[model samples]
Target: MIKSGETNSRSFPGITISTDLVITGGGLSGVCCAITAARQGMKVVLVQDRPVLGGNSSSEVRLWILGATSHMGNNNRWAREGGLVDEILVENTWRNPEGNPVIFDMVLLDKVKKEPNITLLLNTAVYAVEKKDAATIRSLKAFCSQNQKEYILTAPLFCDASGDGVVGFLSGAAFRMGAESRDEFDEKFAPSATYGELLGHTLYFYSKDTGKPVTFIPPEFALKDITKIPRFKTFNAKDFGCRLWWVEYGGRLDTVHDTEEIKWELWKVIYGVWDYIKNSGNFPEADTLTLEWVGAIPGKRESRRFEGDYIMRQQDIIEQRTHEDAVAFGGWSVDLHPADGVFSEKPGCNQWHSKGIYQVPYRSLYSRNISNLFLAGRIISASHVAFASTRVMATAAYVSQAVGVAAAICKEERLLPADIIHEGYIGALQQRLLKTGQYIPGLVLEDKQDLVQLATIAASSELVLTGFPGKPLLKPLTLSVAQMLPLPEGAVAPVVFHAEATADTTLQLELRISSKPGNYTPDVTLATRTIPLHPGRNCITLQFDAVLEKAGYAFITFIKNPLVALHFTEKRVTGILSVFNSVNKAVSNYGKQTPPEDIGMEAFEFWCPQRRPEGHNIDLKYQQGIRLFQAESIRNGTDRPAGQPNAWVADWNDPQPALTLTWQQPQLISYIDLVMDTDFDHPMESVLMSHPESVMPFCIRHYRIKDAAGNVLAEKRNNYQTHNRLEFATPVTTDTLIIEVEHPSEQVPAALFAVRCY
Candidate 1:
């Protein structure tokens, strides 16, 4: 090394990089977008301001990612966001089921690192943007402090997944920072000025209990009197991290510019609460509790949301409106917080749940005036009311995945972001996304090029479910529980429930289904029965006189009666599971969401399933066996459970479960895509929760593919992802294809959602 002659003025070393797509943000939205685009054959540059990936979900902030199936706290059954986001979450569970935030960082970093087409620049902040025209972005100027270098990133397409929407803001894209008035969009659920115009930044602290006594002393700036917080009594040494999510601030100030001030205030609140719990003589049990870790930065909820062609409003979410260009879905409630944040005299949030998941149209994902700019995450084109729901991490990632796929098409078609919609290529965009396991509500994969659609599909055995044989486990009816089963479009089947009552009690049972088809709300009650129980084990027959208008998942609900205990079975089927009328306040589930009359939200019961190792199917015998699981379901084009199971589940008794597809003539087959069952109903939370199993029991872990010549093509030992894609090194001409699968356990049968060979 040689000493340099210092000049009057010097600049950092500069480099110019060109990529197909420039994703500004390293959060889940940006990460998923980058991965999706890179996988689709685009050179992607992912710029992040932080040291690590996963904006709010990263270890710096440590907020667990959640979307539809809102913590399994809503009625969105089988509603997990699919595609690369699902892959990331499923992998996180397998690697870090214990919810170590640092482990989660490893998962994201590892995924991005694996993508060869991606260029990830960590600690790179994009401060300035260059415009090609008044309506397009030309390039972005970013600086990396750690490397002491400057980067000029140029791309045809630009995506603003940045939480603060730096690119969108700098590019002069139309954006709204504050809440819209109720009369503007006719959004009745719009937040009143006193309620709050914006959701604020949140910080979290982790605590641990030592076997020996421990103590904590507050810093000089630490809040001495926790009484300043309205909800001071709610804070305890036992709850930390995301469990203390309500501890927020900075809504009243400029969220973008005053973030540092907000961080200080949040720090003041966190330390104050810790001081109150440790030093206040409230409880001697706090002697062993210690602050393990505290977040240095804050997790932001709202900033400047960019504008696109269509601004989704209140009715769009609550009414579950459909869009022709629907590319993604969001089911999280229309959740809004107060401006006063932690110091508010009101409840922390005024959350309102929809009856079902709402679609995010392609029209709302791109800048309306800016021709080449695409929006993602908290900055997407949505009204203040709609953003409350779509602002969630999983949903944001799902929306960005659509953007990624769209960007690939844009680059290939020589088009801008809005051209796909105006040129009537939205269907192509949706179909392409569906091929990659992205779930667009009401959309099904219809690939004419798939070879399996032409083959004569036949399975050795299909599940003809009569009912699960009862196990010895007796669960008390302390909470309302239901057995969810898909029925035919005919008379309701009679079910026999084996239960015992310690004391005499009346068991009230109701048969309910969603008001709309393809929805699992259980809002419409078809019939009700009140049965008297004796003080011993008894067989109760619930014969509903209801006739179905259409086939859908029906709920057999047993109202909570503490005196009665029902038998539950260990037998797990792919499409069948049980739901409980539960309350998980973490995601705003309160048994039932009851809102004021004019708030635009209806009161609906939450029928959610318990996590694995706990969600045993209720043992109920059906007089007529349900024969919906057929071998032909493999080529049906749908991946997950819809109005029907949309999957082919093998019979439990079948020792060698296999499916064979025969073609009249030999065909060249080189690629295979199999959609495995991963318990889509179960929300694989990124952190703060422990999953019962690493791999979904319903997934076919061990599987082999063979040709008619009896030569094995491929064999997988431990498959966990929902979408298993295999591309052979060479094409094989085969007249028939055979798929043999092994169940993970005796309880769960091997099931395949869709298998496509081309």
Candidate 2:
């Protein structure tokens, strides 16, 4: 190779690329959007400024992704975001149970690389936008610093997922940089100037013990004094990384334009905190610890929020209001951080949780004025109060998945984003998202192409919920514990709880359900019973004498009794879980959420399930068997547990549980999608959190499908994913199909949410 001296200021190489969709940002939102669009047969160009994907979740920032499950802190039962986000999370759990940030990066890269239709541009920043007209985007001019090349990306559709609204800003899309006044949206949760209008940026660091004493020298730039950070005393030797999410600042500054300044401040803070630990004589444990990693960039929280047809407000989240164009859902509390961050003497954050998961409308996904422009990630159309709940990585990803599918619909139909609703394609969009395993609150998949619906189905042994068999394991009722039971709308059955008490005491039993159907929060109490407990083991009968008016989950709550120890079973069912009214400090849940009276937030007790190997079902006996799990339940279309446990669970004793579908005529089938359980209640954070198990305990590990002649159609083993889509090498024509599932483990029973044959 020969090198030539540059004459004048020669331009770097430039190229033009055209695609069906252009998604700006390599964060989870854009990554998921590109993946979804690529899977839907759209050519997608994904642009990122960072070398890696995942943005805040990348190894550079190292923030663990969290969303609706809220670390399983709030009362959101089976509330994990579905679709590609769920797939990514499940894959991460399987591949990197250790939650290594680098491994997580590989997972996102692997997913993007496997999609043939997605052209990912790493280290590319979109600097300019070309508009076809005042309302539509024509193309984006982006430059890749690594290759020193400029790219002109053209697409009919443009989705701006860049965390700070880079594309939207360049396109002149309507946006707001700070919080709106309370009068703007009539939002009571609107923060005052003192509390802060925007959440701040956070920097994280990791420390590891070297087994031998290590010394650290601080730079002159490091903060010399330790007391500068009011919360510095709360720091421990083991606490590191995003666990120090409160190590934040710069909300009072321009979050986008002043990002460099914010990052520098964070760097100074990081080194200062490290220096304090090493030399301040407070942490002796730091003698053997060394900084393994410090974030290269600060994880940004709030910034520019764009405008759409509908701006998500505080009421939509707290009231769980339905949206006609509802395409997504979120359950995380309205979490806002202080503007002063770690420097402020106030608490790090103010959070207000809703009663249940609420729907997100498609109207809020596209720029109101920019016809072809889509808003996603933290930049989506939402008021300050609403953005807090929607800003999390997974929630943003889930919403972006909708944008991806909307792009596909738009491309195929030659329609604009608003036409998705105006032209009556919204239902089609929702159904398409559901086909991809995305769950929208209060919506069920009604696909006419699903052949399983037309077939007559019978199960080998459907679970009649008489009760879980007793185990030797006994858990103290130190806090209120409840068994979540699926019930019918008719006469209620009495239940018996076996318990041992250190002293004779009275046990208070209450039956509760959510006020609204399809919500798991036990906000409405239906019945109560007082039972006597003896010093020795006692079989207490709780006769509620209550009759339900509608079918839903019933919480048989055992009030806190320190003297009583109730039996818990190892038997795990797909949709059934035992919940405790307790605190998960990680998410700042302290049993009950009693927010300030004027915030327009509801107060409710958080009855959340524990993670696997720990969340066992309560051992109890049903006076009358409840047949909620029938073969017909699978065809109802609702996959995950909504207000009800939308699953057909096999009996615990059924050794060879199978569902056989017999059709009147033989039909050819090309593909089949089976929806299994992966413990949607578990958050499955992609980084920094070590899960109890790689595969969800409720996931069916082995399953087989057979045709009329008993020929094996397909067999899956060690399967941990929630969606199992199987395409045949050749079309299989059969009048009868049988699916047999093996229990995931000895503790968990086999369960199926839905079966679709196309």
- Against the unseen true structure, what C-alpha lDDT does each candidate score? 0.91, 0.90
Off by over 4 Å in 1: 470-472, 503-505
Please provide, for model 2 over 174-286, each residue's C-alpha lDDT reduced to its tens digit, 9 standing for 90 to 100. Answer: 99988889899999989899888878999999999999999999888887777889998897888898899999999899998898999999889899989988888888978
Deviation in Å, model 2, residue 321 alpha carbon: 1.1
Candidate 2: residue 415 lDDT (0-100):
97
lDDT digits (tens) for residues 307-366 of candidate 1: 999999999899999999999999999989998999999998878999899899999999
Off by over 4 Å in 2: none
- Look at candidate 1 and tell me the lDDT of residue 159: 96
Q: Whole-model lDDT for model 1 versus the true structure?
A: 0.91
| Each candidate structure's count of clashing pairs | 1, 1
